[model samples]
Target chain A: EPEVTQTPSHQVTQMGQEVILRCVPISNHLYFYWYRQILGQKVEFLVSFYNNEISEKSEIFDDQFSVERPDGSNFTLKIRSTKLEDSAMYFCASSEAALNTEAFFGQGTRLTVV
Target chain B: AQTVTQSQPEMSVQEAETVTLSCTYDTSENNYYLFWYKQPPSRQMILVIRQEAYKQQNATENRFSVNFQKAAKSFSLKISDSQLGDTAMYFCALRGNFGNEKLTFGTGTRLTIIP
Candidate 1:
């Protein structure tokens, strides 16, 4: 079974520093998304990308956050300046279609900002 | 806007017993999708089961099944013959059939299958 793969299972960065989380979605899938879960909290949608552009984003996805499909399979999320609150588990997901299809999730990247 | 609610924060059941996790959701769209995801200590999100709002028949995968009441806006997961490996956090999620493909997940219910 093909699955979304994320690099750097765990990362620790200082406040005000930049961090890039990488993900390689399933090759055939077109829609991609980035979500985050704070410790003991529900998963929150940050942004969704399709057609190599952002389709939608939540309020939590502010200017500091950006997502790019750098290549055919690589989807990356960059945080220009990390904050203590940015510490959480980031998940990458992809789906074949925008609706009715299940979005497969990656193992997740745990980002800890000190 | 979509909101998924898992009322039970935690639950425990004896091994081989049956356990049910409750979930309710609010969505304006008539057509949508519901899903149950499992997260074990490894913290990896695993898709367990899914249901289409338009389909009245519930979805079942092996020992995992769902009771979906579209009228009541309720979708619950039932794990039968639960094993110790079934212990994990379960999240109920909702996604509309139209624009915005993002999934809205519940707070999650921690389930423990005791030996």
Candidate 2:
């Protein structure tokens, strides 16, 4: 089965440095999303994208955070400057459409900020 | 956007026993979908089952099943013949039918099937 795949299953960055997490959604998927979960916390939505534009974003998705689908298959999330609280597992997910469909998730990129 | 809530933080079940994970969601949309995902220690999340809001009959997949109540906005997951491999974090998610809305996931319930 085709699945969403993310690169660098683990990432480490300096507190003030930048990081870009890359993901390749299912080939035919139209909707993509980025979510994060702090250790021992609930998964929180960061942003969603469709048709090369962002659809919706949560409060946590501020100026420092940006998502881009540079090409047909690759979707990337960039954090301009990382913070300690930014340390968490970042997930990339995709679905066939915006409507009633199940979104598949990647193994996740564990970002550790020091 | 929708919100999913899982009340139980942790649960334990004996091997081969049945266990239910409680979940309730709040969504204004009439048409949508609900799902249960299993996240093992490998950090990979696998879809366990799904329930369409329009379907009155509960959905089942082998040993996994869902009780989807549209009236109450509740969707719970039940695992039968639990095995040690069943030990993982179970998350209930809600997705809206409108727009490319992302799924709203619950905090997750850690389930352990004791041998």
Candidate 3:
């Protein structure tokens, strides 16, 4: 089955440095999303992207976070300044359509900021 | 704001036994979708099953089934003939059928299938 693929299964970055997590969603899907889960916490929605732009974002998706469909197949999340608290597992997901269809998730990128 | 609650933080079941994980959600919208996602040690979130709010008939996928109580706003997952491979973190999620709505996920239940 076709699946969303994320790069760098694990990443280690210095605090205050910039980091960009990349994802290649399923080719035919129209919607893309970025979510994060802190250790032992529930998954939190960060942002949703459609039509090459952000359609919605949560309060946790503040100034430091930005998502881009840099190309037809690549969706990327960039964090300008990483904080210690930013350490978590970041998941990328896509759906054929929004809301109605089930969203398929990638294996997730473990971001570790020290 | 919508929220999903998984009351049980952890649960264990003997191999080949049946186990049920509880999930309750709060949503104002009438039409929505509910899902159970399984995350193994690999950390890959896999969709186990889904239930549409408008449908009264519960959704089942193989040994994985759900008891969806629309009126009570409850959606629980039942895993029968549980195997050792079933050990994972299960999350119940909810999403409204409206525009640009993101999925809301529960804290998750850590399930262990003992051999």
Candidate 4:
């Protein structure tokens, strides 16, 4: 089965540094999303992207975060300056449609900020 | 806004036994979707099963089945003949049928199938 793939299974960055997390969604999927899960907490939606632009975003998705479909297959999330509280597991997901379709998730990229 | 609640934080069942994880959600939309996802120690999210809110018939996949009560806004996952491999953190998620592509997830329930 085709699955979403994320680069750098684990990443460690210093506070105030920048980090880019990349994902390659399923080829046919049109809707892409980014979610965050702090340790022992529920997964929270960060942003959703469709038609190469952000469709919606949550309050947690502030100025520090940005997502881009930089290419035909690559979706990337960039953090301008990482904070210690930014440490968490970041998941990239994609779906064939915006509604009534399962959003397949990647293995997740564990971001650790020191 | 939609909210999924998994009241049970942890549960354990003997191997080959049956286990049920409870989930309740609050949504004003009549048309939506519900899902059960499994995350093992590997920490990979796997979709175990899904159910459509409009459909009264529950969804089942092999040993995994769901008891969905639309009126009560409840969706629970039942794992029959559970094996050691069934041990994982189960998450109940909700998504609206229109205008929203994001999934609202519960806190998750840690299930252990003891040998």
Candidate 5:
């Protein structure tokens, strides 16, 4: 089965530094999303992208966070300046359709900020 | 704002038995979707089952099924003939029917299938 693939399964970054997490969604998927799970916390939606632009975002997705679909296959999330609280597991997901459709999730990228 | 609640923090079930994880949500929207996702120790989330609000008939996928009470704002997951592999963190999520694509997830329930 085709799946969403995320690179750098684990990443350790310094506080105040920048980090980029990459994901290659399923080729035919039209909607892409970025979600984060803090240790012992619920999975929180950060942002959603469609048509190469942000469709919606949550309060957690502030100015420091940005998502881009640089190419047909690559979707990336960039954090301008990482903080200690940024340490969490970031998940990438994609769906063939937006409404009433199931979204497949990637293995997730674990970001640890020191 | 919408929120999902999973009251059970941890639950254990013997192998070959059945287990149910409870979930409740607060949503004013009439049309929406509910989902149950399983995250193993590996941390990859797998969709176990989904239920659309408009569908009165419960959604069942093999041994995995859900009892979604729209009026009560409750959606619970039932795993029948539970196996050791069913051990994982189960999360209940909610999504509105409009153009909103964001999913609000519950705190999660840790399920252990003991042999």
Candidate 6:
């Protein structure tokens, strides 16, 4: 089955530095999303992208975060400045249409800022 | 706002035994979707099963099944004939059918299947 794929399974960056995480969502799927999980916390929604624009974003996704569909298959998330608290597992998911359909997920990219 | 809750932090079951993980959600939307995702050690989130809010029947996939109570807003996952491979973190998620709606996920339940 086709699945979402994320690059740089793990990312380590210095505090105050910039980082860009890349993901290739399942082809033919329309809706794409990014979620993050702090160690033992719930998976929090960061942003949802569709029709070439961000549909919705959470309060956590402040000025530092931005998402781009750089290409037909590549969707990237960039953090302007990293902080220690920014360390977490970031997941990329995509659904064929949206609801009722299965949204496949990538393994995830573990981001660590020190 | 919608919230998904998983009360049990961790649960263990012997090999070949059965285990059930509890999940509860709060949502006023009439049409929505519920899903159970399994995250193994690799941290890959895989869909275990899904249930549509409009449907009254429970959803079952292989050894995985769900007990959904729409009225009570309770959705529980039951794993029959558990195996060591079944050990993983299970998350319950909810999403509305409306536009641009994102999924809300619970913290997760850590399930362990022992030998």
Query: Which regions in candidate 4 have their CA more than 4 angstroms from the true location?
Result: none
Those runs of model 1 whose alpha carbons end farther than 4 Å from true positions after fitting are none
Output the better candidate (5/6) by DockQ. Answer: 5
lDDT of 2: 0.90
Off by over 4 Å in 3: none
Error of 2 at B67 (Å): 1.3
Query: Which parts of model 2 have CA positions greater than 4 angstroms off?
Result: none
Of 1 and 2, the candidate ahead on lDDT is: 1
Q: Candidate 4: TM-score?
A: 0.99
| DockQ result, candidate 3 | 0.83
Q: Write the per-residue lDDT of candidate 5 for residues A30-61, one digit (tens) a residue.
A: 99999999988999999999998999999999
Clashing pairs in 4: none
A1-114: candidate 4 lDDT, tens digit per residue:
899999989999999999999999999999999999998888899999999899999999999999999879999999999999999999999999988789999999999999
lDDT of 4 at B63: 100
Once superposed on the true structure, which residue ranges of model 5 sit more than 4 Å away at CA? none
Per-model TM-score, in order, reads 0.99, 0.96, 0.99, 0.99, 0.98, 0.98
Clashing pairs in 5: none
Please give the distance, in angstroms, between residue B103's alpha carbon in candidate 5 and its true position after superposition: 0.9
The digit string of per-residue lDDT tens for model 5 on B6-109 reads 99999999999999999999988989999999999999999999999999999999999999899899999999999999999999999887678688999999
What does chain B score (TM) in every candidate? 0.98, 0.96, 0.98, 0.98, 0.98, 0.97
- lDDT value, residue A108 of candidate 3: 97
Model 1 has fnat of 0.87
Error of model 5, residue B112, in angstroms: 0.4
Deviation (Å) of B29 in candidate 1: 0.2
Chain A of model 6 scored by TM-score: 0.97
> What does the lDDT come to for candidate 6?
0.92
Which CAPRI tier for candidate 2?
medium
lDDT of 5 at A106: 97
Local accuracy of candidate 6 as per-residue lDDT tens digits, A35-104 = 9998878789999999999998999999999999988899999999999999999999998886668778
Determine which window of 10 residues in candidate 1 chain B has minimal summed lDDT. Answer: B93-102
DockQ of each: 0.87, 0.76, 0.83, 0.84, 0.88, 0.78
Error of 2 at A8 (Å): 0.6
Model 6 segments beyond 4 Å from truth? none
